[model samples]
Each structure stands twice: as C-alpha cells, then as structure tokens.
Target: ASFRGVLTNGGRGGGGGGGALLRRSSSIRELPRRFSRQLSRRRSSLAESLPDTPAGWAASTAVLSSFALGYELRLQRSLTAPPLVFSQSNPRNDALRETLSRRRPGGRKGILTRDIKPSLWVGTRGTLSSAAAYALPHFGRKRRGECELNARLNFREVMTMGRDGASVGIDWEVPPEKYDSSLCRRKTSEERQSEILEGPIRKPVVLILHGINNDASFGYVRSLMRACTDRGWIAAGYNFRGCGGVPLTTPRGYTGSYTGDIRDAVQQICDRTASPSVPVFLVGNSLGANLITKYLGEEGYSGTLPPNVAGGVSLGNPLHIHSGNMSFPWAQVLGLGVRKSLFLTRDKWSQMTCRNFRAAFLKALLVCQTIGSVDDTLAPYLIRNDPVYPFAVTVGYPDAGEQYWDDASSYKYVQHVSVPLLKVTAQDDFLVYGSSLRKMSHCLECPNVTVVKTRCGGHLGWQESPPEEQREGEGRGFGTSSWADAAAADFIEAIIESRRKSDKEEEAIKKAREEEVEAEVAAARRRRKEEEREGGGRGDDDDDDDAGNAHMERRSTSEREGYIAARVAAAAAARREADEIRSRL
Candidate 1:
C-alpha cells in the first residue's frame, strides 16, 4: 500500500489498531529514503538544465574542486590539530601536574619550576579568536586611554644618560605612603657611589623596560608601574632613547642587539636610590624583554651585574630574534591591519617630521610585504643609512655573516643566566610565532628559568575574566589588571620569597658545616694529645697498645658515621626547600 494510504488506514482502523500502527511506522521510516532518492533526481535535473558549453563545464568543475579542496584542508587541519586539554582541565592544572611530577627526588638541581594559571572566562576558546579579542582595543589611536586609577598614581619623569650619550627617560612612580626619603633627595654622583659602597637600600624596586617605540605613557607601562606601586615597590619605567616622544640626542635609536643602553638605564635607576644592594627586579615586555634576557645572560656570565638585581620577569619576549624576524610575514599581516585601522582613524603615520626616522618607517613599510625582505631590505638599510648617528656595528651586531644572527638571538645566552627568570608567552601572539617560541622553550631547561605558556594572549595582551564586583557599564581596563600583569607580579614575589628561603637554607647548612668542622678539629686534637701521651711512655705494653688502637678505631668509625648522617640531613633539607619553592611558584 502507498505510505499516505497506510497512514490514513491506521487512523481510520479501530479493531486492528496495533497492526495498522506497525504498518504506519514502517511506512514513516521508509519516507526519508524515498525523499533522498527524489532529492537526487532533482539534483540531476538541475545539472541537466545547465548549458553543455565548455565554459559551463569548466565553471561547474571549478566550483566543485574549490569545495573539495576546502573540505580536504579543513579535514587535514582537524586531524592534525592538538586536542584542547583545557576543555577538560585548566592549563594551570596541567602545568601543576607536570611540575609536581618533575620535582621527584634525584631530579636535576638549580632549575626553578613555576606554574601560572590564567583565569579565562568560559566560551573563550580558540587561540586566534582570543588573541584577536584581546588586541581589539589597541588598534586605533597611538595614545592609550587613561583610566582614573592610573591617572591617580603620581609619576615623576627623570632623564638619564644612555651608554651612547643619548637621553633616556625614566618614569619613577612610588606609592605615596611608602615613598623613600633617600630617593627624593638627589645626591651628587660621588655621594651616590659612596652610599652604594656602604650597602644596598632596603626598599624593593621594579624596573620596567617597554617594547620598541613605547614609553611610560603606554597603557601597559602605566599599568605595570601602578601594579608595582600598589605592591609598595619603587616602580621605574625606563623609556628607550628616542621613544618618549623625544628625538634622540645622537640620532641612533635602540636595537634588539644593543644592551649597553639597558645596562646604563639599570645603573641609573640603582644610582637614583644610592643603593647598590637594593632588591631590584626587572620587568620587560616584548623587545624590551628580549633585550633584558640578552643583557642578563651576558652580564650574568661575565659576573658584572649590579648587586641589587635579584631576578627578572619577561613577558611576550622574542628570545629567538632571527626566528622572529624570519616570521615577519605573519607579523606584518596583523601589524598592517592594525596600522591601517589607526591610519584611517587618525593620520598618525603622517606626523613623522624626522627625515631619518621617516626613511626608516618607509623602509619598514616597504619590507612589510614579505618575510625575508625585512632582513634583506630594512635591516641593511638601517645598518648603512644612519646619517645622523651611524649605527654602531661593534656594539651588538658586529658581523654581517651568520654570526650576526647568532649574536642577536637571546636563546644562546639563556644558559648563562644565574638569577631566576620567569618567561611568560602565549600560543597565539601575532607578532611572535609559536615555532620561534618553541625554540626558546629549550632554554627553559636551565634551572634558573621558569616559563609560563598560556593557551591564549596575543603579544602583551592578557585579559582575564571581569571581576565579580565590577560596576555597571564599567568594562575591564586593558592593562593594569591584565592576567599577564598579575602573573608577572606573582612570579616576582615568588622569586623573592624563594631567594629568602634559599638564603636561610644556605645559612643553616653553612652553620651545620662549621659546627661539624669544629667538632672534627677538636676530636683530632684529642687524638693527637692521646697519641703523644702514649708515645711518652718508656715501655709500652703490647696489650695496652692493642687496646688503645681498638679505642681509636671505634672513635674514628663513630665520627665518620656522624659526618655521613649530617650530610644526609643537609641533603634532605635542601630537597625540602626546593620542593617548597616549587610549590610557592
């Protein structure tokens, strides 16, 4: 029977209701297959309606091929994609698990492990999408929007001399209540040197190094300064030469390879407080972070770092400079979009007055078209055409060969860093490629380095979930309260605390060793005195001599056992301290 006829019969029948219902159900199930066949027939009819000309055939084939290619590409991507473990568990939890597992007894010593779990809101999935959302606010207007909280913080700007005689601006922001009188009272260079010789000051100072073309006025910089101030730290944002809206004194601006300027800036900051031993921690973002890492590695290996530098926190650092430069095409695509948006909104690019600077900018714009073109065109142009202040080739990039790339990369220097270094990076940073970052991750094998890799957070863009008590119509600020900012601060604090614990452990171990040595020396003197007394006897009885030897052997055995026990205890204590430090981080 026809499907519709069976259904009508099922509704009409009362006596054979069960039989009619079964037939109706079977007919309903077959309807989909029948409809599918009809759809196929319709598709065939539609295809037949098209012209039989070569152009029509070519257009149809092209359309199908494009769809097939897209489907294949999508399928390949899905197949190769790494599973998002964050869906089941937080990335922090995974880090914690890994850290704990790695911290077992007999593990490698001197390596500091840190875990940071950024609180992301639900539905914030996909690295690229999250990065785009985070970077959405900074596209237009070079000037960052000033939040009331940031504006309230009192900032004083001071000009310091760079290594090349260029003036560098340092924005000093100290919490009003915790202001140090010594910092306020400017002393002569001689007096400052004298004070440093005495000892480092007691206050904690956080020195911030901004990225290329950025200064203290940048929202992120201000946010970092404010966060430091809130934590009762002396926040000093060091603006690279010619970056703080001021032309360079020597026409030469900062470069990734040059670290002398950073060293000079750090020295100037330390001098301001007249404390060589003050607890100073460096915080650097992007290029600034890369420079800091390079400086730390170089100075650390040379043992020339100022006594006050405790450790550092580097955010969105491109440690592999050559690799990063090689990935310029990806950076240029995102960077150009942002630049274009800014250009359309406000003719910001047109405001350039300096000839050399304009030329550099134009070269950069020209090189943005491709990846290798940056190194071939812009790099060479910058090196050769610095008419005002010639590029100092000997400072950082001394060679034009392969050595130049090696020397410029910070990855090679990571092994030499002596102090704790916390490196924070994101998987989807537009300016930095994941592959380049992976190359740098190898450096994290060092004991003093701790790397925190988040699933999302575009270059220096780490936005967290809004707070529970957020006011109506008030959106989250882009900088001061970002996840990256909080993570940096936490890592710094953890490093400081770990250092203190380590110092205490060392002191205890030292004291134990000293006591053990004194005890051993006393025992040796006693043995010597007993030997002399025994030797003084004219006639030594054989039985007496044998007894004395036995006693001496027993004492020696006891002393050796005691020494081993003490050493074992010390090792256990060290292990415990290491575990505590890892947990805290």
Candidate 2:
C-alpha cells in the first residue's frame, strides 16, 4: 500500500518519472540497492539527532548534566592528580630535565605522575585546600606553641645592610646544641650592624623569604628552617625591613616592589661567607615568592645575579597583583589580613613627620575594603614623600595603585629570568587568577624557568595525603609537611649535585690539558738536546746556538702565557659588550 502511494505521487509529478520509479523499484530487489537505501536512512537519522546550533548544544549539555553527579562521584573515588610542568624547548633545560629524572626513577616524570596527589578531603578546590594546609597545622595550642617557641629559641636575629637609614633583618636558625654566645651580638651605638660568619658555609645556604606581614616567627618559616637544617644546610629567613621584630629606622617601610633589599642581602651573604663557591638558594613563599621572582627577573635581565646563586624556588606566588586584587571575596579577605598586619604595627607610623600622612594611613586602615583600595589609598603618598629612598618625578615611579600593581607583578618580568627557577603554583591558589596563570605559562619563554601547576594546592599550601606506610604510625598524619618543601629541597640538592659533577669534569679536563702541555715541553727539550749532541765540536757557534735556543724557549713560554691571557681577556670583554647590547636593545 505504501509502495502504491509512492508510485501514484511520482506518476502525478511527471510522465516519465513514474516509469523511472517503477524501474528503480524493480532494481530494489537486488541486495546492493536494498543496503544503500538502509544506509541512507541511518545517516539521515544521525544527521537529525546531532546538534548543529547553539540551542541544540545547550540541550545536549543539559542532558549530560543529568548524570554529571554520578560521574563526579566516580572521579572522586579514582583520583590521580599530577602537576603540569611547563618549560621552553631549549638546550639549557637539559640539566633541569636530568635533575627531574634523578628525583624520579626511570625517565623524567611528566604531567601524568601520581606522586603529588592532593588530600581527598580538600580535593582540587582552592579555598578548602589553602585553609586546610595553612591553618589546620596550627590549630592546637601544643603545636602552635611549639612552633612559636622554636622560632624564638633557635632563630638569632642578624642585621644586614639594606637601603640608606634602614637595615634588613635575617633570622638565622641555629640548633640549641650548636648555639654559640659569641655569635649573638648585643645592641651597639651603630644603627646598622654587619653580619660576620666564622668561616665559609660549606653546605648550601637556603635563604627563606616569608609572606607579607609574616616573618621568621611564623610556623611555616620554622618548618622550612627545620627542613633545611635536616639536610645539613644553613637556613636563614630574610626579614623584610620593619619585620622580624626589627623596628624601622627610616620612615619608609618594606614594600613588595623593592628589589634593592634582596640584592643587598645576596651581596652581604656572599661577602661574609668569603668563599666564592658557596651556593645560596632563594626560596620564597606566598608574597615573598612574588618578590623573589621580580628580583630574579631583574637581575637575570641585567645579567647581574652573582655566581654563587645556584637557583631559586617560588611557592604559591601571586604573579599578578592587580588581577588578583580584582578577584571576588578572596580579595577582600586578603585585604583584611593586610590591614590587620598594619594594625599590629600601627605604632611605626608615629615617625611620619607629616600629620596628614599619619592620618591618611589610619583612615586607609579603617576604610579600605580591598587590597587594591589600600594600595591606592596609601602607596602614592608613601612613595612620593619617603626621604631615604627618593623617587624622582621624572623617573616614572608608580604614583597610582594600579601602576604599582602592574610594576610589582612578577609575570611582567618572568620572561627575562635567565637562571634556573622553579615556579610552583596550584590551580586552587585563590590569590592567583586563572588568566594570570595562563599568561604565566605563555610568558615563560626562558628555558631556565620550570613551572609546576598542580591540580590542588592552595596558596602556600601543598599538603598531601599520607602514604600507606606513614598512615599507620602514631605521629604520622596530614599537614605534617608540604610536598612543596620536599620538591624545593630536591630541586636545590639536584642543582648542587649537578654543579659538583660539572666542577669535577672541568678539573679532569684541565688536568688532561696540563699533562699534554708538559709532554710537549719535554719532547721539545729532548729534541734540542739531541741536536746539540749531533753537532760535534765545542765551538763559539755551538755555544751561541745553545744560548739562542734557550732564549727562544723562554720567549716561547712567555708568548704562550700572554696569548692565553689575551684570549681570556677578550672573551670577558666580548661578554660584557654583548650584555650591554642586549640591555640597550
């Protein structure tokens, strides 16, 4: 009945069409025709079912969302998160690759490694992870008190040279058993005190920089110190100006934008150590991470970081301050923290000679609701009026909060960093913006910079779940230590080991070259002696020949030394010239 209806419709359309349809219908008896008709119907059905419009896409998404909860539950049950490592393709990264490989057996661990799984409770949420990792450790009185006591008893405050009229404080952690009375200095008449080391620090010196408004007194800093000490390395926390119980001598206080203090600190550490080969590694946490990144970038761009600096590690750095300040709820929360820190040090503002400045500072503390607002309210006035560190109007020092944030942003300068740097950030770091992180991965053009973006680590919080072996122990639990600490330690240790290996290889090559030169000198002398013996008769000519040959040998040795020296000097000069050109360009 359906075939007769189709034929009637075709016959009504045209005269020959109905005859052609009849012929085709007869051919439908064949297997190929039947199969083709079925295939055409299936494709037509698929084409109708699939989405090709925005509305259709939304409908399809809604259909998927119905079972998303079930999928999420299954995902939670089988969680295996690893960090995403980003680095440029260049020959300079071979050492970094080898370092990573050494840390993990077999080949270098990639983005799929399951070693850095986040705590199940925290999952990959930024706020939860951060709060748990940073706050949970100090919840109990016993734990908190112990950390505070350790900070008080072990860390010795040493003043180092900084900007004019102000000095930077360094809290050096020395165990109670190793404490020497001679190392501690009483208050002297001099405003700035110099740090004197007994001898070169043979092991690596890890200089830790604490976050904003925090100092060596913080529990995390104490933990870091312990970690460094456990590795038999010297640990010191760099207290920003007016931090670490150090009162501000100058009216100006420490700001995150200042790189001068870090440079001065590195210079002092190197000079006091007296050993050029001593390794100094910088590890900055939270705000300190941003500061260290900026400092390293500036130094790397200028080609001025000292030879003693092995590398640097930045933990939970807020790369873009302006963008971060604009983020919801978190920005206001961070601002309140900063305001509280200022409130704690409210007495320091008494030194301001201008009544208006002091009043503005107090007002800003009271009224500012966000970090951006606080900076906008006070930074301009502070920078313009500071006596010790003068910023000329023409020099383009940031006068507005936005300008200051842009200048202070580490991402702006990260591309220029030429040294080995490990940037560890988590997807859950509320202080960092998603856009800023994406920009960071793109901006890191230098091969020396290795970025580790983990699935879940809150700001300065990299707490991992305990392994099976440690889970059963009495003292073992979560929040005991951070994966970041171990990673940073491994990175620094790997660099040190690589450096030692390189030095040994260089020494071996130098020795071989010296031996080759000595052999050549011996052969020349032997040839000359044989020539002297072959020339019979003890005559004046023979004596003159011997004297001339001796003179030639002396001249040859001096010429060789001069040639080598000239080559070295030329190489140095060329390097300086290249640096100047690069800087100018």
Q: What lDDT is reached at residue 32 by model 1?
A: 100
Best by TM-score: 2
- What is the TM-score of each predicted model, taking all chains together? 0.54, 0.70
Residues 1-585 of candidate 2 have per-residue lDDT tens digits of 766766666666454577677778788668687799899999999999999999999999998986775665555445446677777777556666656644253333522244665555564455766665444423211222234323322445556544454677887754222224646653321211222344444557788998876776675666566666655577888888778878766555667676767777887777666576788899998889888888787776556778888889988887777734557786787679778767766777766788967876887789989877877776665432111122222212446677677667778667667668898887766676464576686457766888888766677766665433331111113434456766787788777877888889999998997677666666666666666678763344555556556756786799799999999997798578557745643
How high is the CA lDDT of each candidate model? 0.57, 0.66
Question: lDDT of model 1 at residue 22?
Answer: 80
Per-residue lDDT for 370-433 in model 1, tens only? 4333333334322221111222334222333244445556776666576777777777566665
Model 2 alpha-carbon drift over 4 Å, by segment: 1-79, 90-92, 103-114, 136-153, 174-198, 323-325, 382-398, 433-435, 441-443, 468-480, 537-585
| lDDT measured at residue 245 in model 2 versus the true structure, 0 to 100 | 78
Steric overlap count per candidate:
3, 0
